[model samples]
Target: MPSYFSLLFKQDFSDLKAAGNSWEKLSRKMHDAFDTHRTKVTGPLHANWEGDDAKNALRFLEDIETRVQIVQTEAMAITKVIDTTRHRMEQAQKDLRAVVNDAEAQHFRIDDDGNVRLPKQWEEPQPDESDETRHERQTKEALLQDYQVAINRAVDEALRASGEGQKALAELDGEILDHKNKQMAAESARDADKVMDQLGLKGPKVPDDPKAAAEWWKGLDADQQREYATLYPGRIGAADGLPSDVRDDANRLSMEQELNALQRGDAYAVPGNDDRLHNLQTLKAELDKRDGAPESKQLYLLNHDAGGDGKAVIAMGNPDTADNVAVQVPGTSTTMDSTGGQLTRIGKLQDAAENADSSASTSTVYWLGYDAPEAPLMEAANTDVAGPGRAEDGAQPLRDFTHGLRASHEGERANLTVMGHSYGSTTVGAAASGGEGLDADNIAVVGSPGMTVDRAGQLNTDNVYFGQAPDDGIGWAQGLSLGRGPTHPDWGGTRFETDTSGHSGYWDDGSQSLANQGRIIAGQQPEEYVPPGQHNG
Candidate 1:
């Protein structure tokens, strides 16, 4: 039998942790010194010095600054790795000891040598030993087995991480040496703005197809990717085929730049800037509100813009790192001004999904990236805003967004659920019915107007889900001008029950609809979710 955490409570973890802390402290000191030199020494030289001598001195100073900053960055990264390894090791040791102690309390013997032995008394029970005693022993044994499995996995992970961290630390000196000696000259001469283009990394071929897009994205190295995103954020931010996290970062930087330009240009005061300024202010307010909210600390701004009525996609958690991701597509009349309410709706779904599976994490994104119809109360509402015009325009973008999520995802594959509500459902359906499909695992619609497809199977997804409030008047428009409602008996999709809160009430707090949505997103068994009409009984 292998030893259980034989290295537990060892001095190596502490030694590594101390070394990491010292390195980080030293790195910080070096960085601070470089900053002082740049401001005090280099600043005066650049202003007062003359000709070639001054130019050479300034270049040397810049090189030293870059080198110091690189070292600081690497040191911080190494420190993080060491800290992670130490934490894992500490937790593993604790878990192993707890398992052994618990087993000992249950009348089992676990020696200091890391041997878990069955009690001698239980090896051959007396004839008088009660059936209850046997049952208790059996339960205890099963519990011990579970604990053993957990600790083994934990120990393995900790050891692997420690080894990798040590290797990385060992290689850092060589890496720094190469950067200074071999790459310094080229890096110094390289134009920051034209680096991507010079390296043949500029103007990436963004394919319309999602799979092709993923391939294009995967081909770029870290440096190339960073440069492309930084230099041409506007194009990359709106590009459909890029990864979600990458797009998110680029979009955020772009948004800030756009806001600054708008402020500088006095956009609100300009003749034709009313729409753009209004959109920008609304988006800014929504972002501020979300940022200020305590519950939204983990939220990430995936995308945002001030173009045309404005577009935004905000995730309550990192979609790239989550085990499950739900994209909520809002319907007609949804704009940048309405984003907060949409965010709230999707944020509730985020919590619900995480709460349903306490062991896992979920991401919910409020997708206002499309130009939704501007439905008004006038008689032309049905033919204008409620028509298929906007939905058709948005179908391709919606498909690309889902595909981008899949391309950028890390770790295990996540369950991707695309949900459409009202006219938004029509948009989802249009995309799903297209030849390329929406690239989602599950397709769900709530209070759908129509999906444009005749049947659920046309969605090209593994599972199709539908929910509708009994009194939802939106369902009445099914088959008239929109697509067929998924809940229709002929639609052949699974129906989930929702409350009587009418249209847009499916996501209401404490509602059955919300619970079922959570269950579906978590990849739980269908039988676990309560279907429609089950709440009354």
Candidate 2:
């Protein structure tokens, strides 16, 4: 425990902060050095050199790289612990000074050791003393107790902060540098979380309103932002209003942690854990393939869940900076395992949109954030797809996500579009009709069963559009008491032509359906569909 006297007068946090900065600089330098080594030494050796000697040399270089990375990670952990302690101690010092100043202002004397003393008073009441004088003395004594309590509380807070800081510093053992690559990263994150818990700096309770959530994130200092993102990646990653890059970083860390845990066989108790593991691996592979790709092609992972049927939200480009943004919600049977294919589809959509208008940038997202109904072909009749319950439950989340996009976007507002396929159309419809709606400029549904609404006007958006292949069987679900699906002419929305066949072929490259979707996403009107009998030469 720290002494009250030291906390009140002698403690200085500048040196600690400086040390933290030094560690941070060292970590950055180490990272740069490692990158240089890989590019200049190992990369050439692996590409040009051969034989056992070359392999041995490469192995040695790889070990060196691993060791350097571990050192860098450990350095970051040290910086976090030091910076957190400095912040906490500085706050405690500020509190102590505040209470002491208030005590002095009120004519109460505070000693060097934090003891409060009343201003000079008569040792005893004299026989000639007036009643008012005695009462005044009594009042001063009572006030002295209050000042004392305040001083004691401030000192206790300082002591607690100091003790926790000490514990956190003690846990950053140098031996952590001896661990393997993945182990080092996971352990470092785990240790940071412990420090955060000890210092009472757990991740914030994010607000439901996307605007409020964005403001809340902006209010945190840089150190606190980094701590929260590193120590509680899962929570920060999933928070809607955070910046896309920040969310991407946090989610990547979370995915790495999940993969490490699953590899260690720690998730065996979870049902379908193997499937979860496979899905995560597939996602990682897909992301890795995009490394060093163009900025427009880079994938930003907004969120993910490996449990149950699994879920994920991925963006093909940075939505915050794009001129146009579209969120495409998948229908039934969508899960983490299907995320790779979904990413491919969104990429194609992005390309199509960009091709429509070369002057403006576009970002397309695969929003599998909701738990859509999943069932085998044999059990399709018993799935949640037959009911409006899942769509109703998912509507609020979908709305929140879109609002978050609105809150976090930079510069001019984006031309936002929300699209859904199959049952996902039901979710989009439900979201667009309820609450404040999906905050979208256009709502499009392909092969939609129903939108959980009777008309496009009910969706609160005038730019509603629908596309359904003639042979698609999913249209039968509209008769199952969902809503008046957009396929009907009386639905009061534009119907786009679909040149492809089957329920899933709408996204085939260069098809009329895909082209029309691209046009809608680019904020342009698609060519309206005319019934075969209605069209005349």
Task: Give the least accurate 10-residue stretch of model 1, judged by summed lDDT.
Answer: 184-193
What lDDT tens digits, residue by residue, belong to model 2 across residues 1-537? 645665555687788889998988776677667656755666556556779997788667666765565456567767777787677667767877877788788777776778877765544556887889889888878887877777677667667766777888787653544535444444554566666677666557888788898999999987667656655778889999889988987787677667655766663225666877887777776665564456798778898887777788999889999999999999988887787788888988888788788899999999987888886212458558777888899899899899999999999999999999988998999999999999899998898888888888999988999998889888767755678778766788999888999889988998988899999999888877878788735
Show where candidate 1 strays beyond 4 Å: 1-205, 266-271, 292-297, 376-380, 525-537
> Which prediction has the highest lDDT against the true structure?
2
For each candidate, the alpha-carbon lDDT, in order, equals: 0.68, 0.79
The sequence of per-residue lDDT tens digits that candidate 1 reaches over residues 188-231 is 11222233332233455577766676687788875446545644
Q: How close is every model to the real structure, measured as TM-score?
A: 0.60, 0.81
